[model samples]
Target: MDDLRTIIDKTLKQYLNAKQTPFKDNQLANYFRREPKQYIESYIKKTGFHFNYDVKSSVGNGRWAIIPWIVLFDTDISNSATNGIYIAYLFAEDMSKVYLSLMQGWTYYYNEFGTKIGQIKINAALNYWRNSLNLTSSTFSTQDIHLIDPSKRYDTSLPRGYELGNIMSIKYDAGQLPTNQKMEDDLSLMIQSLEELKSKLISTKDIDLSNKYVLSRTNIIKNHKRTPTKRDYDQQS
Candidate 1:
């Protein structure tokens, strides 16, 4: 059995490397970057928002490969607040499948001595850490979770999925370091899903973003209206 580090390295390489047989000459390769941090920074530059990788594999944990990251859509996020949102890819037990999740932080605080306050005070301003509420497509359908509803309170419990937050996701099943069409298709799905999620997040932040895809569902809907029936055409004539 391969360790988590080796498996992840191989999986990502097969999924993105141009020299690899399956992904060669594929447009999907353009979206993937071998260096995850640089890739993330490139994405941030392209979209003009803060995106940072929050988790990665450690030498001790051989069975798990989980990489979670935050998208700082709310630039005004309080420095001391342990509250934010995240998106991540979590490897399954056997490392054959990955679960993509979007989550929100539920934070906790403690009381500490504050000379400025002259006494021990609950440091609500100082973030301790956060436990997330799963907000991915696993909790809601794809159509439902793309954009944030301005009127809906995400922190409240009205809608099932929105009770935590909105999210988008796609599963990537690259079997035992697969290097074939299955891997290609999976990567495509993952990339497209990430792009959609990023676009929606930017839009939710009220920032105007132009989607890179020239021919998307939105464009199709805008360019092609429903055709009227022959009877309607005759009547108009």
Candidate 2:
């Protein structure tokens, strides 16, 4: 990702300096997504892992996104931030650091089970994944990642969902990124880690993955008032 450091660094500087929201015509903002996305594509291609990537700086067509991101996904697992689990590079709104995270999709649970139950589901999945993935072998963090200020409330809670949904991640300073060798190694491990989740998912019969795949299915997660029993997370499904 050394090649990516230039794009990531310059774009953050430009975004921090922008007097207005970034738009389609904003050459620098657009390049942030357009240019780096190609490097991501080639990088993943080298791993021989089948993944689709999206490098985004803004949402809709009019404004800069609160948090710009690049996601690598398997179509069967997820195609967007709306549902399922995927790996992504998330930029903090304050422009301090970027995180490469194996995170969950919160919207699917909210739409299916409502906010309360949705959160429960997310926690259960987090427990299951954290235990199953055994992230100790990697350099990624198992701690919480902050994307935006916790005090401010937004019209959309997507950013909050991101904060709560992170399972494991690695932080990269915006000003100082890792070398090419370090980045390449991280990518390989990330891809392998995601596959471990996929293997567990294959055992589950019900998953509202993306909007397209699990159109009519419903996922009813285990509900617990306190610490769950061993059986609560014994089955990944």
Candidate 3:
């Protein structure tokens, strides 16, 4: 029964003592991969909640990457939705804070540079969830979540993309770590909100159509309007 605070503490510890860079750190990489799985499985068992969820962890690029991330997708809606939305739990390096985000989908924009271009679609989805759950008091932060289109910057290497539908993030200072009780309370709130959002999404009749239109619009721009990169061709092949 690993608590959420324990998970955050361990991540901080690993980040501080990490000898290897973000990409090459096998120890840190394994922590993100293993911890999320254990925590999610244990949470499901303990809470007696039947959630069809999928867990994924990644140590992006390997060289300069410091933050390893794990995502938990309520596959019930993710698999069926247009944007392939999911909940992401990211451990950042600067503040050693945890960022909770509702990710719309995985796509990149490369008009000049590259970015995630689905603000309208993602906003619609956000409104749908927020309104359905009556999350009027729930505040969403784009502090850690990059809301601007990165393509405007024209920096090819600037890592951007991952449309954040809604984000609720927390930061821990240099010496301050969240207490177990605090982390549990935060996690509880997040989980409850997600559960309600998932239920509403699954039960909604026009959800499929809405998602379809969003996906189609995105594809029209990415596939037809934008020039295909070598990676795209390779993927098609």
Residue-by-residue lDDT tens digits, candidate 2, 180-203 = 678768867887888777776643
Error of 1 at 141 (Å): 4.2
Assess candidate 1 and give its lDDT: 0.31
Off by over 4 Å in 2: 19-22, 50-60, 134-136, 203-206, 209-237
lDDT of 1 by residue, 1-237 (tens): 332234444544443233333433443232322233344344445545433333322211121112212222223221211233444444332334444434332231111112222111111111111111122233223322222235545442222222232233444555444343443344334334444444433233321111111112121222222221223222322
* Lowest lDDT block of 10, candidate 2: 209-218
Model 3 has an lDDT value of 0.52
Q: What's the candidate order when arranged by decreasing lDDT?
A: 2, 3, 1
- For every candidate in turn, the CA RMSD to the true structure comes to 19.6, 5.9, 8.0
User: How many pairs of residues collide in each model?
Assistant: 0, 0, 1
Give the lDDT of residue 133 in candidate 2. 77
TM-score of each: 0.30, 0.79, 0.63
- lDDT tens digits, residue span 1-237, model 3: 456666666776766456455456466666766777787777767767677777766555444344456677677666421245666665554434556665555332133223344444444445444545644223444444542344455332322444344434444433476676665555556666667665544233344443544343342344333333232222322
Which residue runs does candidate 1 get wrong by more than 4 Å? 1-34, 47-83, 106-168, 176-237
State the displacement of the C-alpha of residue 222, model 1, in Å, after optimal TM-score superposition: 46
Arranged by TM-score with the best first, the candidates are 2, 3, 1
Pairs of colliding residues, candidate 1: none
